[model samples]
Every structure is written in C-alpha cells, then in structure tokens.
Target chain A: MIEVKELVKSYGVTGVLRGLNLTAPNGQVLVLLGPNGAGKTTLLRILATLTKSDSGTATIHGMDVAKNGELVRQSIGVVMHSPMLYGDMTVSENLAFFARMFGLPSPDRRIAELLQRVEMDRRADIRVRLLSHGQQKRVALARAMLHSPRTLLLDEPESGLDQRARCILEGIINEFRSADRSVIMTTHQIELGLQVADSVAALERGRVALHEPASAIDIAQLQARFSEPTEALGAL
Target chain B: MAEFHSERGSGDQTETAPTSEQQDSGSPGVFVASLGVIWAIARKDLLLELRNRDVIVSIAGFVLLVFAIFTFAIDIQQADNAELVGPGVLWAGIAFAGVIGLNRAFSLEMERDTLEGLMLTPISRDLIFLGKALGNLMFLAISIAIALPVFAVLFNLVVFRLELLAIAVLLVIGFSSVGTLFAAMSVRVRAREIMLPLLFLPVVAPLLLASIEATADLVAGDSWSEMSQWLQLAIGFDIVFVIVSAVIFQFILED
Candidate 1:
C-alpha cells in the first residue's frame, strides 16, 4: 500500500534520501532499520506527505504523495516519538478532538473503543501530562487508531519503552497485522522490529543495504551482517 | 538486495484518483465539515488556555501594569490632555501586551510539535488558522473586558459605553486576524518574541488610527455619521485582512 521510486531528498547540500526505492505490500509490516541520521524518519516523512521529495515520487495507495496529500493523509495514521497530544487535555479530550478532526461518526463510542483497545479506558479523564511515558504511548496509540486508517506510520515507537512497554507496543503492531492493514515503522530496535516485520529492509547511507523476507534471515546473521564494515557490502 | 519496487500496479497512476482537496471541495458537506473542524480546533485551544491560564494571566498583569504606569506618568496637571490621549494609549498597551499572549498562544502545540500532527489530518490548513485566530480573539476579548473598567477609572477615559465597546471588538478582531497570522509565522522563527511585534505593528497602523478616531468620536459624543469613514475603514480592514490572512495561512503552514 506504500510505494517510493528513486526518491532523492535533501537539506541544502546534505542528501538524506539519495536515489532510494522501497515498497511495502498491504496486510504486513515493513520495519526500516538504520542507525542515527540514516534518513529513516526522512523516508517516513515523505511517505506521510509531510515532506516533498526533491525528485522521483512516492504514493500511498497508488496516489501521488505530493499531489494527493489530503487523501494520503486520510488513509494513514502516524505516531512519532512525541505523543503529538496536548499535555493539558485529558485522554478523552485528545481522542475527541482528533475524532472531530477526522469527522468520525459517533465519536463517543469510537473514543470509548479506542481507549479500551489501548487499555487506557481507566485513565480517560486524566490529563495526558500526568500519565507515565508508557501510559502516554497508550493514549497516543489510541489517538492514532481513532480514525481507523488503512495505513499506519510509526517513527521510533519503542524509543523509551521498557520491556513490558515494548511488549504492549508489539501487541499493538501485531493487531495491525491481524487486521490485514499496511504498517510502515522506523525504529532501531533490532529484535523487536524483525519479530513484527513480514519483510525487513536495512538502510545504510540513505540506500537500502539489505532487503529480504524476515524468514530468510535469522536475527544472529542480521546482527553480524549489521556489524560488518560498509565496504564489505557491495553495490546495491 | 535489489531496490524493492512493487511487482503489482505500482507505477500506473490510479484512473479514478482525485486530489483530496478536490474531493473535499466537491462534497456538499465540505463547508459544514470545515466549519466543524475549525470550531472543534478552536474549542481545543480554548480548553488549553483555560487549563494553563498562563496566557490570560500574563496579558492581564501586563495590561494592568500598563494602566498603572500610565496613571503615574501622566501629571495630574495634564489630566485633560491625558484623558484626551487615553484611548490611544489604552489600545497601544492592549495591542502590545496582547501580542505577548498571542505569541505564547501556540506554545502548547510547540511543546510536542502538534501543529505538524494537525497538518497530517484531512482538515485544510486555513481552518487551523481560523481556529487558532478565534482562540486568540477570545483571549483578547477577556483582556479587553478587564481593561475596559480599569482603563476608565485609571485614565478617566469613557470607553465602556456600548458604541465604544463595539469599536473595541471590531478593532480587536482586526488586530487579531493579522496578529494571529503573524504570531503563527513568528513562533517558528528563531527570534520569535522579537519578531512578532516587528512584523505585526506596521500592518496594523491604519486600523489603530481608525480605532483611535472612532473611539475619540464616541468619547466626545460627536455625531455617529461624522465617524462613518473611520468605522468603514476599520470594518474594511477587518474583512480584507481576515480573508487575506486566512488564505495566506496555508502557504506558511508546511512541514
């Protein structure tokens, strides 16, 4: 459901995504693994229609990202490291606001369902700033799913979560898979990413260094390959 | 690994595809939906303002400070002239102090960078601008409400009367329409606090002059028809600036 072709994006003289291409089929998750400054977030931003690529084109569900951004926006749900919610507003308020933004029908029921799905129904009235990081992530998750978007885009979702929180996060990711929805997530968590991805791609220097079915490569080999020098990997 | 281009129906553009804006404009309910989104967003902003009370408190304190300082600075000997100049000083203080509140209005969104999050929604960017502008207008209304009584007693100015209050509201809306637009633009700049007034003041000079003239007329009990041109100028700027700023807002709101 997500597509990119020979995309080149840059900031001034610095190139972030240089002649890159990627595709993730619907009904599975594609986790982008890369080190810091590897343009993972840049790639996701382009797909999210938040940033326009310098050249080439990216489309979500076969519509040009730059030209059809509004449709792309409606189809995709995004969760970044930040909760992207008002700290002062209650959990229910955040969801209600977003529900209204999406013009969802019967928002009260939808908000209730989302809060319950994220296991945040109990704290619905509590202010978001008062919630713990894990709790905030839970609320954030509920906010992202409120619109029932066809595609999910997550950036560094597990950045600060503990093992238990990671498990919860993984469960949310797994839920998307079971529903046959497309998910594109960018994270540095190796084991967790591999566990959820139907296909995995590793980015190096803004180019896909490795792309394959998750079942084709074990975590041990992936780790060892990742540790090797850049020169060892031949031309793409 | 080879670059992962799709094997099925990737490059071929969808035949039925229409831009989301086109879809929205084509829809009959688009106007109502946009209005709903605008009001919903504005309500969110108002809720945040009520919770923090930070912007309101700052504006109130600064407005009072302006009044108190003006009271002490104006010699009792020049009481008549001070009363004559009161309307201008009152607006000057409110405009300057209110812009501070406007500058901090989006600070909540700046914390988690939620503006970009709003951009990801299907709502048009102009609606977000209107929502925020309305929220700021509310803040200005609150400050002016408090200042009206205090401004009268402190400076011996006759500003609380109905006609003058109407003029105040019109001028406030005019100031806020452009003020809110520039505040959003300035908040993103590095030197934002300094940038806001520098960008805001010059554009608002005509409205300020009209406000002073109209308020002067009301204070002097001059014929309403005599102040018609000033009222027309104020209303004209209010309508034109609001539409222009609403349209221009979309261009500035980008990731």
Candidate 2:
C-alpha cells in the first residue's frame, strides 16, 4: 500500500504540497483533481520518486520515498502529459528500448502484447513523430507498462485522447485494477475520471480540500468544491 | 480503494527488477547496468550518425580546411617553427572540430524530445551522461583519425610516431570528456550555441596547452624523460575532468 503523511514540497519561497496526506491500496484507482498550479503534478512526481518532499514521509509499500527511491521507482509506472517519448524512434523501437532499460525478459513478446492491447499493433513500426497525439499517448502507455509496475501514476492521461483512445485507456486502467495494481491518476476531465476512479482527491493551494469515495461525491459537490475562492496569499 | 503493496511478486518480475536489498548491496550491479545503458546509447547514436553522414562529413571537412588554413598561415619549412607550431595546429584543428561535433551530438535528442523520454526511464543519470560522452568521443575519435592523415598530408610533416599517437589519444580524451559534459549542460539551456563554447573553452584550456606542448616534444623526438611532465599533466587534467563531470552531470540533467 502507498502511505503518505504530511508530505511537504516547496520551490524556493513557493510551497506546492503542504502537509498533504493520502493513501491508495491495491486493486483500485485514485483520481486526483485540481486546477493548474494546485500541486497535483508535484505530488504525483514525488510519488513517482522524480521529485523529493521537503518535510514529510511518503512510503510506497513500506519503503520510504526519500530513502528507498529506487525501490519506489521499481514499483511505479508514470505517464505524464508530455508523453515523454523519443519522436525519432518507431513506437516498437521505443518500447523495446525501455524494455531493455527495465531489463524485461522477452521484451519483444511483451512489446507485442502491449501494442496489441492498446490496439496499436498495426502502427508499431511507424515512427512516433508520425503518430497523432492519441497514438503517441497509447505508445507512452505501452512504454510505462513495459516493467509491469504495480503502481501507475498518470498525469492528465486523457487530455488529448479521442473517444476511442479514451476507451482504450479506460480499458487499460480497468485491466490494471483487475490485476491488483494501485493507480493514482490526475485529470481535469471530471466526468471521465469520476467514471473510472474508485476514489477522488482534490487539491487547492497545496492542500487536500476534499477527498472521498467516488460514490460519496456528486458532480455538483465536486464542482462547488473546486469553485471555492483560493486565498490569494496562499496561491504561491 | 485497494491497498498498495510494496512487496512485488518475483514470478513475473524482469531481471532488471532486482530487490532493493540487492541493489543496495555494493552498487556493482548498478554500475554494470549503467555501463550497458551507456553502451546502448552510444551504439544507437553511432548507428544514426552512420546513416545521416552530415556530422561526420562536415566535421572531417572542417578539420581538413583548418589544417589547410594553418599550412598557409604558418610556413612549416622552418625546422624550429615546425617543431614548435605543429602541435598547436594539430590541437587547434581537433578542438575546433570537436566543438562542432559536440554541439550536434545532442541536437537529435533535443529536436526529437528523446532526452526527456530517456530521463523518465529508471536508468541512472550518470549513464545518460556517460553514453553521450562516449558517443562524442567516438565522433571526435573518428575526426581525429581523419584529421591526423590530413594534417600529415597538408603540413608535409612526418610526426606520426608511437609517442605522438599516445599524446593524440590523451589529448582527444581530455577534449572530449569536457566537451561532452559541457554539451549536456548547454543542450538544455537557451542560447545553447553561445553558452556551450563559453563554458567549454575556459575549462579545457589547460589540457589543450599541455597536449600541444607534449605533441611538440614528441615531434622533436625528445626523450620520454624530458616530455614526461606534460604527459603527466594531460593525464591529471583528464582524470580531474572526468571525475568532476561525472559528479556534476546529474545536477545538469535533473529538471
């Protein structure tokens, strides 16, 4: 299980995550909701072990995020809005490269399976630069899963996906959940996140303003929660 | 929500996923893995450059042209001057061509956004730096090979000996190490073209100076005893830069 206690991160004089605390168990998806600059990305990055917290403890399983960052990284798969792909490489080439990086056995077979799962097997040989935004996202998803990580952290994963691509992404998440992987996804697409997420957490000015089960929070309540006036002084 | 489990099952785990304890047990495995990653990056870059041909051709052409210019600029027929100036011209060509190659080494990664993608992989940052450095070294080495023949042909100088070869290798290693390190730093910054030369030249000056003197001594057929000091200086410069660059590279690579 992922456990966080009073997680705090700051950039110079500006604080991002302030005493943020949350948890996600296996076999479920936790959707993080927040507007821009609300520390959602920072929190997720910290969880991915890409960024460090200033003054709190974040433990993935029982390993401390700061002390056991490599362990945390070994267990997590991350997909950022950037897609973070090599445009010069073909989709299949990119996947194989990451497979080798993560030292996956039978990388070729695993790559084929992921491409087929994402329904991009036909375009696997195409260079990533030629792929559309949705196609690139699919490739990124496949890249993330190369190691078969137990925890998935996606930031605005559905932003550029078309309806079909979105459906494929939802299916992927569903499959991960069924396989007992814990997922923490951040997105502004409220209805889509609501549909798939087991729970929702909202951030406002670096604090968790609202967090509850998806069933417990209605659309109106969610919308109103985001509408609350963020204190200007605290908006750094 | 389901609970997150820290203990991952070993059955489906790939060989890359060594348990945390194994990873922490001395770091030899990590080092070996890093070397593998570096080799892959260098190999990939070399394959791409072989296909593209622009960088190799341009750098080789530039080094040849620089030698031609220096031939006219310095009348090598004068024995005293030829012995003193030959080393300078050789190194000048190398340094100039090296800068050109290093500048373009990361051009592909930056243009294609491959750098960001590489960073996201669990590979250590040092591996990325080493890989890029090795690729730059390969490019520079090839340039040196071509330039050496061209220098001999253009200058009408027969300074190609075993000692000279050793000095040339030392010089290239020193130049490429700093070149690769600074290239990584400049690739991520704005005004990179301006920034790279600015950062590289000052740091690499001592090595270049030492190399030129050593090369001059070798050309003069001076005994190893007399030239040993400059060779030692080159070695010292190379080791210092490599260690410094290895430690500092992560800072430059981190977002």
lDDT of 1 at A224: 73
**Chain A vs. true chain A, TM-score per candidate?**
0.92, 0.94
Listed in order, each prediction's TM-score against the native is 0.90, 0.87
Candidate 1 ranges with C-alpha deviation above 4 Å:
A218-221, A224-236, B1-28, B76-79
Which tens-of-lDDT digit does each residue in A1-236 have in candidate 1? 77888999889999998988888988899999877777899998888777888998888888898887777777788888788888898999888888777666456876776677667889999998999887887787777766667788999787666566677777877777777778899866676677888999888788888888888867667767666334323211
Candidates in order have lDDT scores of 0.78, 0.78
Question: Model 1's DockQ?
Answer: 0.27
Model 2, B57-108: lDDT tens per residue?
Answer: 7678888888888788888787676676778888877787777778887777
Calculate DockQ per candidate and list them. 0.27, 0.29
Worst 10 residues of 2 chain A by lDDT: A227-236
Candidate 1 CAPRI classification by DockQ: acceptable
Clashing pairs in model 2, backbone N/Cα/C closer than 3 A: A1-B4, A1-B5, A25-B2, A25-B3, A25-B4, A26-B2, A26-B3, A26-B4
Q: Put down candidate 2 lDDT per residue, A150-189, tens digits, no spaces.
A: 8888998987787788888888899778988788999877
- Interface root mean square deviation per prediction: 9.6, 6.0
Q: Residue B21 lDDT in model 1?
A: 60
